[model samples]
Target: MRILVIGGSFGGLTVAFSLRQKLGARHEIVLVSKEARFTFIPSLPWVAMGWRRMADISFDLAPVLSRWKVGFVEAAVIRIDPAKKQVHTAVETLDYDYLVIATGHRSANEAVPGLGPFDGPGHSLMSPPEAEEAREAWTAFLDSPGPMVIGCAPGASCIGPAYEFAFEVHHALARRGLRHKVPIVFVTPEPHLGHFGVGGFGKARQFLEGEFEARDIRYRTSAAIASISAEAVQLVDGPSLPSRYSMILPALSGVRAVAESGLGNPKGFIPVDAHYRHKDHPAIYAVGVAVALPPVEETPVPVNFPKTSNMTRQMAAVAAHNLAADILGGAPVTRTLSAECILDMGDRGAHMFADPIRPPRNRSEMSIGRRWLWAKRAYERYCLWRLKRGWAGPASGLLG
Candidate 1:
């Protein structure tokens, strides 16, 4: 049997490595990705603040996959044909008995006019290159301090990074004795602070609010960014804020290749069942931001639901288990959609665990302290080490 995984990030790598362990040498497994290296995305904020370098968070994917005896293809997938069971890349077309679509998300910077690294004056930490650009921008900002605005664009799902970058920026500026000179303003589309794209997590709202207050980081909620200018950011609600430096998180959309495949939703996210199998195509599965998930509830300003790294890893595990069940004979597993995150605030951090992801959950835990900051740093190293060794690190269950 042949299984193909299209992506080399958290979800894709987890699925590929887990399946290889389960199926052993009996089946063929291939992992395809556009990039040659895998980057630890959570550390991008630190990269932006110059606390971490790209090399510190990224490693070549070919060597790791080679050690696992899995074939690696470094090419952009142009299309996927569920009916034909084929994946077409820029250079080749490969057929597979089972397919996992973990292609992740593309930054929908065009959603808001003049918002993005390429077309706008603002910076983003979504990708490794973007993080490097942000680091350069940060260094330049320190040379001439001024008012700054940081927040997520409307429909942004990955909101944690925005908060992390904001606090980290505050911490960096304060350490350099430029905090008073450069006033920091946070703006978000969420109705309130700490909504985090899934309503609000336990006491997270209060905790974040208190932290922002203590840091003197003023914020504006229900803020829809209309456009970004080199000199300032304009809101749809008739407010214009002066900001010499702006870092706005762009909304996520489906990769163009996935969208054109005719297997994705309007927003380009693949619709999947509880088992992470595609709703229309049984042999195809999806995880991470590539899968479509509705918001817990609607708000005045649109907010796409978040898909954290932990939750994505959980989805990958479930999909891998179900695929093994189909081929090796076992009970299929279902995803729990659990989330575990450690939000770094430069010197301090907040750790949150939400089972089922929505409110009124069975388990919801949150805590903040300096120890968590160190814990988060350690987790980065541990995660990279585990992934490089082709192990499926804990996503859920007791260890998670």
Candidate 2:
């Protein structure tokens, strides 16, 4: 049997390694990706602040996968023909008995007018290029300090980075004795701080509210941005916040290839069952951000569920187990994912843990300190080292 994985990030690599270990040398596995390198996305905020570089967080994919005896195809995927059981790529078309879609997300910068670093006055930290662009903007802003705005646009699922960026900016400015000059404002679509698109964890809302207040960082909740301009950010039914520099996380949509192939929903994300198998295509599986998950609760402004790295790891493991069962003869696998995150806050960090991503959980923990920051940094190095070596050990309880 042959399996094709269409991505090269956390989801794709974990699925490939897990399958190889389970099936041994009896089956074939191939990975197709547009990028030749795998970047540790959690470190992009540090890159934007000049605390880290791209080389420190990324590594070439071919050599790493080659060491593990997996085939690598560096090409952009054009479409997947489920009926024909083939994938068309820029380089060539390949046939497969099973397929895995983990193409990640596409930043929907066009959702708001004038919201993109390359095309407009706004900036983001989703990609390497965008992070580097943000770095350049940060350097320039330091020379001429002014009021700044940082937040997430409507429909944005990933809110941790925006918080991290806000704290990092404050810390960096304070270190340079310029914090008093820069008035920082945080805006979010969530009904309140620490909702995290998954109901607030124990004391998370209180903790965040207190932290922001103590830091003197003003914030707007349940706010919708109408548009962004060079001099200010306009809000819907609210006052315009003047901002000389801005970084806003835009909404995300599935890649065009998946949407055109009729494999994803109207928003281009795949719908999967308990085992991470596609509802329509039994032979196909999806993990990570490619899978569609509804918000835990409704908010005044729209917010989607966050598909974090820890959640992706669990989904990949479950998908691999179920795929193995289809060929190796066993019962299917089911799993309930927990929320685990180490949020970087410049010099300090916060560790948030919930038994499940949704509410009414048996366990919820939240703590903040300098030690958590050290742990976050240490985990980044350890994770990259392990991944580069292709060690597909256990996939549970990873603090991402």
TM-scores for all candidates: the values are 0.98, 0.98
Q: In candidate 1, which residue pairs clash? A: none
lDDT of candidate 1 vs native? 0.90
- Give model 1's clash tally: 0
Local distance difference test values of all predictions, in order = 0.90, 0.91
Tens digit of lDDT per residue, candidate 1, span 1-400? Answer: 9999999999999999888888889999999999999999999998988888989999999999999889999999999988899999989999999999999999999888878688778889889888899899889889998999999999888999999988898888888888999888899999999889978778989989999999999999989999998889999976899999899999998899899988889999999998999999999989988999998888988888999888889898888888888999988778567788999898899998887788779887789899999999999999999998988876523222
TM-score of candidate 1 against the unseen true structure? 0.98
RMSD of 2: 1.8
How far is 184's C-alpha from truth in model 2 (Å)?
Answer: 0.4
